[model samples]
Target chain A: MDYDYIDRLLERYWKCETSLKEESELRTFFSKSDMPKRFLPYKDLFVYQQIQKTVGLGSDFDVRVLSKIEPPVVKAKRLTMFVRIKPFLRAAAAVALIVLCGNITERSYFADDKLDYNYKDYKDTFHDPEVAYKKVSSALMMLSEEIKKSKSQHFPDSLYQNDLDSVCTK
Target chain B: MHEFSFQDDILPLKDKLFRLALRITMDRAEAEDVVEEAMVRVWEKRESYSNYDSVEAFCLVVTKNLALDMSQKKDAQNLSLDESMAESEMDESDPYHQLANNEKLKLIHRLINELPERQRLVMQLRDIEGESYKKIALVMNITEAQVKIDIFRARQKVKQRFLEIDGYGL
Candidate 1:
């Protein structure tokens, strides 16, 4: 093979006059195993270029780049989702806040009506109506028994017992 | 105007972004971070992406800027300057053919890194990434002619240094 073409191309390449096509041609010629001995240094340069081309990010590079850019993409999806549901969420929150305020206001208004009464007076009474009625009935029965015992000395026991039974039954 | 799909467009460019970032930052973790940051920035501006001529070029610009910024901050902090400088020294070694292929690769990577920032970036975009000079010019904010000149100078530097290393071996 003639060496003149490659030599000329090499000269043009060194002068920065070679086009991309010619430069690539030089690269290809140098890549072949049969490169001329005189062109060995240039081969090394081209080989260096070839090897440098292979110099690249590690395989994890994509993952790293994707990870950096991915969050925003997911965030964009999330932002759209947030935008879609924003009105409903705001309305729901407003409803909840209104309900809470209504409850608080109602309790405050009712609280004023009972301020005149001593709260301690009601503290002694049973809160359940049924339990309070039972306690009153038992207290009256104990008082009647005491009265009947004390009056037994001045009246007939049978008469007092009959009257007490009628009253108790009623 | 094309809608940028992370999976279809941005994700696939990870290797290219990583290579450019790695070349500038010279630290794998930092490069990964720069690429990730660039991806995030691109995604954030996704709505405005159609305003540009090319998404890939825009992304390259962003990654290059971010990597440059991060490296500058790293230098300011002086957090691990000694270790980083040591690593940089290793990367700046000359490329000699007598060395193993892997060693040559490492040496050339260092050599390229040793170039001026503009030359280094142009070399990476044009030679290694196989980007068209137009795209490289877009990313670098330079003219097509300037891009060619930068690549030419960078290659010449590599050749000269490479020859020096080989002559030492001889």
Candidate 2:
């Protein structure tokens, strides 16, 4: 191609007059092994473009990314299955705790259990160990309820964290 | 599908994206980061590939967007200079000519960086990407005519610099 024609196209190129096809044609024309001196300024751009087109991610990168995902959590994010449902599970657990703890002051279930432990006279006459066993169980239940309510009502806010912490702290 | 293999699709685009990112960022690491980010993004969004006009155009848009975003996020991230890529490229001219092209490319990158954001985008998409006007418009969220005008201004500014550097007095 004539330098003047190419130079004209390039002039149009920088001015946005060349169409995409025209622009590529200009690049292809200038990308030749030889070019007029006036056109030499543009050779790097096209040659660099041709080089760029052949570059690829090295296999090591693929290996690195695959290994990163092998720990299950990455897979969990990719699958979106567990992530999508995780919030609902946490919300359910939080609401359950709220309901259980919020009503702690009433001691509704403990009141009935406490009523049954008043059989101390019968226990003394019959010398039954079963009545003593029932009393111990009721007292343990009352203590656990108070502990749960205090923890839930205070700092253990996130339901998921609370569940994990409870299991871990033991 | 084999059509989207990293070697075929991504490697082929590396040199182009490297230069594109280099031109926009004027830094090799930033360019590399943009290219890698683009690759990972393409990998992640591969399932949605069928929806785009062409994967090449889609990838270019992604690359350009990431380069733009990275430039905006950190001034330091984009300040480094690019090394001479002249060793890998073919040139029939004297080594000085190659040197000139490299310098011009660096200068072009700087000039393009200072363009209005839209002009910079349109210039990169239309010129560097060799994208069709319609695709450039789509990527830029503008009309084809708007893409054309912005591209025109961008091209003109670069040509102005090119002419000045080459002493083309016109």
Off by over 4 Å in 2: A1-15, A28-170, B1-12, B75-105, B168-170
Per-candidate TM equals: 0.66, 0.49
Clashing pairs in 1: B91-B110
For model 2 the local lDDT of residue A43 reads 74
Name the lDDT of candidate 2.
0.66
lDDT of 1 by residue, A1-170 (tens): 66899899888888987888888888888889886789876677787777666656656767766666665543334468888899999999999999999999999989767565666666554578988898899999999999997877677879879999999999
TM-scores of chain A across candidates: 0.42, 0.34
Q: Weakest 10 consecutive residues, lDDT, candidate 1 chain A?
A: A70-79
lDDT (10s digit) by residue, model 1, range B45-141: 9777664577888889999999999989988887674588476556534222223256565567667878999999999888877888888988998
- What is the Cα-based lDDT of residue B139 in candidate 1? 91
